[model samples]
Target: MIFVRLCLNTIVRRWNSTELTKVQMPAIMHLTRLGYTYAVKFHDNQAGEDYVPDTNILIKIFKEQFERLNPDKKDTFNQVLKDIKMELDNDDLGRSFYNRLVSVSPSRLIDFEHPNNNVFHCTAEFTCKRDEDEFRPDITLFVNGLPLTFIEVKKPNNNGGMLAESNRMNNQRFPNKKFRRFINITQLMIFSNNMEYDSEGGIIPIQGVFYCTGSKSKSSFNCFREENKGGEKVAPYNAEYSYKSIDSLVEKRVLTDFNC
Candidate 1:
């Protein structure tokens, strides 16, 4: 599978274009190329909750992976989802959730030992609502139906650009208590306007794409850089991966348009 961050570097090279073509759609397609399935938006309705982790998909995938990972404990399969849901819901700052995600302490939510044994999905326009407040991220990446990270793409050269999006997330989004669970569930948040980073020594991120873990802090936002074997800065590869009938899939599914 292609590394997601490395694929995200494609945005910088095409920053001057529209949001969908330049960053959002390409990001989704890249993930699909990297073995992530493109989950249709309507399926998000099956989430059946105002909040996230998409319980419908979560339970289904968990059941499958749990059986696969814990073959000897097949009879205990029914309890694992409940345990995971309880742990995820009660998590503080996603610390517990993160632990479960990377390790198998609470339960084997993911099969880190066998990469191909897991399910990877990328969905667009995932909605999360709590009370009167709501958040609809541009794209969300799911592993075994657990929403671990989400991406927000801004129009290139929009007013205030990536900086403005950053402020909105920090000042408006993060401050809302309703989204606390959303924040807890999402381990990473990425914002991009397709602009290149300021190598001219800007102390803070003023352009390009930036990311933060769980939640944001005053100076927590960071950008990605690729280095070669010799440790010299290099550009990201704008490569394509040909899956079976990918051209047909891309053409038929308007959502996966590869005009980029």
Candidate 2:
């Protein structure tokens, strides 16, 4: 009887360690707590090569924010978006996009001064297509409707953990020209397996969360660490963030038995 119980517990533990359960859902939940509005779509198909901006959402948010920021400019929303899209198409590694994000262009894309004036959106399974290629990120974070960052989550204690994921992105994903627009628009990429760095390694990430500004270099992977001035470590969970329905949602969606 005890052996059967232990086996059941082991199965549950393994089941709970899935990428979606261990990291993706929790990340989305945390983002929602951090003031990001959850963006949901019934289908995974987001149209266009530069679906990073999800043109529809971009237009909606841009019009509202742009008109508010540049109140003197009348009916120039379309022109501004067109110019921004042109800049994005001609830019490299999202450099132009980043500029528009931080500073005011001929037109304003995001209100960096009043952060609350900008829209923060978070979504998962963000699928974007470019000709014959389709890249679906595990989680995509949007600022003012532009997908500036995305996260890739892996099952904990997987084959190579963080290193394997980094290699896959740099070797398989980045080199594909079909992903050129996607890569150009995305400013940051984060990877995690819900574990700490416990392996002996020089610079290669073996575990824990790491982020890089696009895949400019394979060696750009850097671990994320937060410490206060007092030398005490700070953690995300240490913050008091909660939602009334989050517990129930996690139980129903994250922890629920797929077999059942």
Pairs of residues clashing in candidate 2: none
- lDDT (Cα atoms) of all candidates against the true structure: 0.67, 0.68
My TM-score estimates for the predictions, one after another, are: 0.75, 0.77
Cα distance off (Å), candidate 2, residue 178: 1.9
Residue 44 lDDT, candidate 1, scale 0-100: 42
Which parts of model 1 are misplaced by more than 4 Å?
A: 1-17, 43-45, 49-57, 74-78, 89-91, 199-201, 216-219, 229-245, 254-260
Worst 10 residues of 1 by lDDT: 48-57
* Candidate 2, poorest ten consecutive residues by summed lDDT: 48-57
Error of 2 at 248 (Å): 6.2
Tens digits of per-residue lDDT, candidate 2, 165-187, equal 88888887777766766776787
**Which candidate ranks first by lDDT, i.e. highest?**
2
